[model samples]
Target chain A: MTQQISTMTATETVIQAENVNIYYGSNLAVRNVFLDIPPRQITAFIGPSGCGKSTILRCFNRLNDLIEGFRLQGRITYHNHNLYAKDIDPVSVRRHIGMVFQKPNPFPKTIYDNVAYGPRVNNYEGNLDELVESSLRRAALWDEVKDKLGENGFSLSGGQQQRLSIARTIAVDPEVLLMDEPCSALDPIATLKIEELMKDLKEKYTIIIVTHNMQQAARVSDMTAFFNAEATAEQGGKVGYLVEFDETTKIFTQPSQEATQDYVSGRFG
Target chain B: MIPAAQPQKSVDLGDLKIDHSSRRSLFTIAMTILASACMLLTLIPLIAVLTYVFLQGFRRFNLPLLTQLPPPPGLTEGGIANAILGTLIVVGIAAIISVPFGVLAAVFLAEFGKGNPLARWVRFATNVLSGVPSIVAGVFAYGLLVKTGLTGYSAIAGGVALSVLMLPTIIRTTDEALQIVPKEVRMASVGLGASNYQTILKIVLPAAVPSIITGVTLAIARAAGETAPLIFTALNSSFWPGGVLEPISSLSVLVYNFATVPYEPQKQLAWAGALILVLMVLMTSIAARLATRQKTY
Candidate 1:
C-alpha cells in the first residue's frame, strides 16, 4: 500500500506537544504523548478505533474544550506560543487553526454565504466575492460551483459538500488545517479527490489528518504518527498512547516497533 | 484419533405457505368498521357546531355585520365590527410582547444554559405556567393592572394577560426547535472561528425559524379565542375602541355577553361573532401550516 510521495526533511517545528495527557472527568483517555508537527507538510495520525487519534488532533486547536469535563495536561505550543496559556482564547486559536469534520456539515445557507460566513464573522473589509472565489479555487471546488453560488449548500453531492466545507474553512485564511477523518464518509473516487486536494493544500498551510485508512496515510502524508490503545485496570476501559512517529515512507517500509509492524501489515486483531 | 463418521441431513426447500383465513378477514373488517365508527363519532360534534353556526350566522353575516356596531336590544340593524377590531388589536399586542421574550428565553435554555440549575427551574416554571387556568390569568391581570389603577380595564391590560397565555407555548416550541438543529452545524460554525453569539444568530436561529413561526402563530390563535382573561382585563364596551389604553371589546367576549340574552337579535349577533372567531382560528392554522412547509435547510 505504500505510495511514494515527495518528503521534506524536518525543519524548525511549527507545533510541539510535550508529555500530553487528556482526560474526561475522573478517567484518563489518552496518556503520555510527544510529537512535533512541521510547517508546510502533511502529517497523518493513523490507528485503530478508540486510539485517541481524533482526540489528539482536536487538542491542537482546542476543539476538545467543547466537551464537558474535558481536561488536558502538559504543554502544547504553537510557534513558541503556549496554546494552553491562561490568557490564550480558544476562539482565536481556532481562527488560526481551522478544522474539517468527519461528516460534510455545511451550513443551511447559500454556497457563497457558506464560504463567506467566516470572513463576515471576522469582519473582513475586502471584496468578499474575491475571497470566496479564491478559497473555492484553492479547495478545487470553484469550477463546479462557480455558476450556482446562490444554491443551497445541501444541494451538492456529499463530496462536493465536503469540498465546500473545506472552502469555508480556508476562507478564514488559517495557518494550520486539522482534518478529522475527512474522507471516511466518501466513496473511493471522492476519497481520492480529497487525497489529491490534501497534497495540494500542504504547500501553503501545515496539515494534520487523523485517519483509520492506513493506505491513505501511506499515499499522501509526508510524516506519520502511529497511536495504539491499551486496556486499563477498569474493565473494558482503554487509553491511547503514541507508539511511533516517523517519516511516512520509513514507517510504512521499516518501522522500529513490533506493534507498528503488525498494524501496518494489517495483522492487528 | 478419529471418531465415527456422522450422517449428513437432507435439506428441505418446501414452498412457503401463505395464510388466507376467512375468519381473520372477517375480524379485520369488523375492526375497520369499529375504528371508522369511533372516528366518525369524534367528528360529529365538530360538524354539528360548524353547520349550526353557519346556518344561524349567515342570516346576519352581511356587509353591515363587518362594518357596524351591535344594535340596541331588539333593533337587529348593526354588526359586531368593534369586537373584531379589538380582537385584532389585543392579539397583535400580545404577539409583540411575547415573541421576543419567549425566543430569547428559549435561546438561553437550549444553547447557553442547557444543563444549568437555572435552566431546569425555568423549564419547570414554564410547564406550570402553561397549566395555570385561563380565568386565573384574567384575575391576575385584574389585580396587577386594573385594581392597581395603572391602566384600568383597558386593552393594554388585556394584551398583557393574553401575552402571559402565549409565553409558555412560544418558549416550549422555540426551545424544542433550537435543540432539533444538529450539533454538528454548531460545531461547523465554531470551527470556522465564529463566536457563540454569531453562531446562534446567523446559523442556529435561522434553521429554527420555520418551527418558531408555527409556534408563534399557534399561540396567537389560542390567544384570539380567550374570553375569560379579557372579561376582567378588557371589560367589553358598546362603543368602538378609542385607543389601546381604553376599554375594548373582543369577538369572544361579545359572543359570551350576547349569547344568553332574552333578545333574539343579540343572540343572532353572538352566533355571527362565534362564526367569525372560528374562521380566524382556522386561518391562523392554515398560515402555520404554510410557514412550516418553507424550506429551512
Candidate 2:
C-alpha cells in the first residue's frame, strides 16, 4: 500500500533470521522459521496463543535470555552484524533495540522519572529536560501529563501509562522497538491510541509487534507473519511453527495459504 | 402409535429469585461464630497483657525515672538512665551490623538466585536460624566473642548476639518485599539495557526500601526486649557503659535482677525500667508503620 510513498526507494533490511529454532529445555517450541524485518516500518507476528509469536519477538532483543531453559539455534543478523556472536553483548543490543511489554508497566515512579530512567541508565549527558519533554511529546503523552509530571505513573489511565512506557523507550534513542502484545491489555480506545502511536513511531524507528488480534495485525502492520501450532507425536503436545508471511493486505485479503486464509476470515476452529 | 410431546408451561427464568432465608446454612453460622470466638480469644489475652503491663508500669513514669541512675536499696529517686543508653547502644550496633547484611542477602536470593537450589538452601537456612532460640544465639555469641576472650561480657558481645537474632527476620521480610515487586518491573529495567546489578540497585532496592526499613525496625524492637541474651553476652553492669567494649546496663537485665530484690525501691525501679522499654518498642513500631505507609510517589 505504501509503494507510492517510500517503497520505490531503497531501504535497508534491518534484521534477518535464518533457520531459527527455539527450545525450552527439551521442548522444541518452534522450528525452521526464517524472516526479515525492514527499517522504519512496522512488522507484526500474529498467531494463536502458545504459538511462539512472543518467543520470536523476544529473540530480537534477546529478552528470552532471562528465562532459565530458553535457548535458540539460529543466526539473526542486525545491521549486518551477527546478533548472537561471541563478542556481541545482548545488553548493548537491547540498548539499541528497546521493548514495550504486553501490559502498561510503568515504574513505581513519577511520570518524569519514568521517562528519564532509560537515558539516565545509559549515561545520557545532554539536557535531560529537553530529552524528557521531546520523548513524551513524540509519544503523544506530553500534553496530557505536562501538568503533573510528579504524579505516579500508575495514576494515569491504562492508555496513558502505555504511552508513558513508549516515551521511556524512545528516550534512549533506540533504533528499533519491539512490542509483545502491547495492546492486548488495553481497551478498544487505548488499543487504538497505541496503534496510532505505533504508526507515528515507525517514521523514526523500526517497529515489531506480536498480537493475537488478527485485525490488529491487519490494521497496523506493513508485513504480517502468521504462526500455527500442530500436535507433536511424542506426547500429544503442540508446537508452534510459521505458516505464512506476506504483505498485510495480501494476507488478509487473499492469503496464498489455506491456514492463513481461514485464520483471517475467522473460520479456523 | 406415534405419541406427540405435550407443551410445557413457560417458566419466567429471568424473573426467578430464590428465597435466601430457606437456603441459609446453620453450619456456616456455626463456623463463623467459632472463628469469631477464636479471634476474640487471641485479642483478649493481648489486650489484657498490654493493659496490665501499662497499668503496673506507667505509675512509675516520671522525669527522674528516665534521667537518673538507679537509687539505693531503700530510696526511689533515681532512674534507669544507664540501662536505657545501654539498650540503645546494643540495639543500634546490632541494627548497623545486620541491616546491610540481611538486605543484601535477601537481594541475592530474590534477584540472582531465584528458584535456584542454592537460593532454596539459603531460604531453608534462614528459616532454621529464625527458629533457633535467642538464648542459644547468646550462647553462640558468648562462645565466639566472650569465651574466646575477644570482648568478654561486653556490649559489643551483646550486639553480636542480638544481630544473630535479628538477621533471619530481616532477610525473610526483605525477601518478601522484593518478591512482591512484580517480575515485569525488573524486565522493564533490564529491557532498558540496565545490567542486572544496575536494575537491582536502582529499581528493586528503592521499591523495597520501605519494607526493608520496617523489618529492620521490628527486629530492633524485638532485640531490645530480650533479657536472656543480655544475661549470656553482656552479663549486666550496675554503672554506665565505659565503652562499647565494656559491660553495659541494659533495661531487660536490670528488670530481671531488681524484680527479685528484697528492697521495695529496687522493685519499683524494675517496673519503671520495664515501662521505658515498652514505650521505646511501641514508638519504634509506630515509626516503622508510618514509614511504610507513605506513598513513595
Per-candidate count of clashing residue pairs (backbone under 3 Å):
0, 0
lDDT string for model 2 (A105-215, tens) is 999889999999999999999999999999999999999999999999989999899999999999999999999899888899989988998999999999999998888
The number of the candidate with the highest lDDT is: 1
Residue range with the least summed lDDT across 10 consecutive positions in model 2 chain B: B1-10
TM-score of model number 2: 0.92
The C-alpha stretches of model 1 lying farther than 4 A from their native spots are A1-9, B1-33, B295-297
Q: A1-269, model 1: which lDDT tens digit per residue?
A: 12122244556788889888999997899988888899998999998899899999999998888888999999999998999999999889999999999999999999999999999999999999999999999999999999999999999999999999999999999999999999999999999999999999998999999998999999999899999999999999999988888899989999878888999999993
TM-scores for candidates 1 onward, in order: 0.93, 0.92
Docking category for candidate 2?
medium
Q: Which DockQ value does candidate 2 get?
A: 0.61
Q: A-chain TM-score per prediction? A: 0.96, 0.94
lDDT of 1 at B213: 96
TM-score of chain B of each: 0.91, 0.89
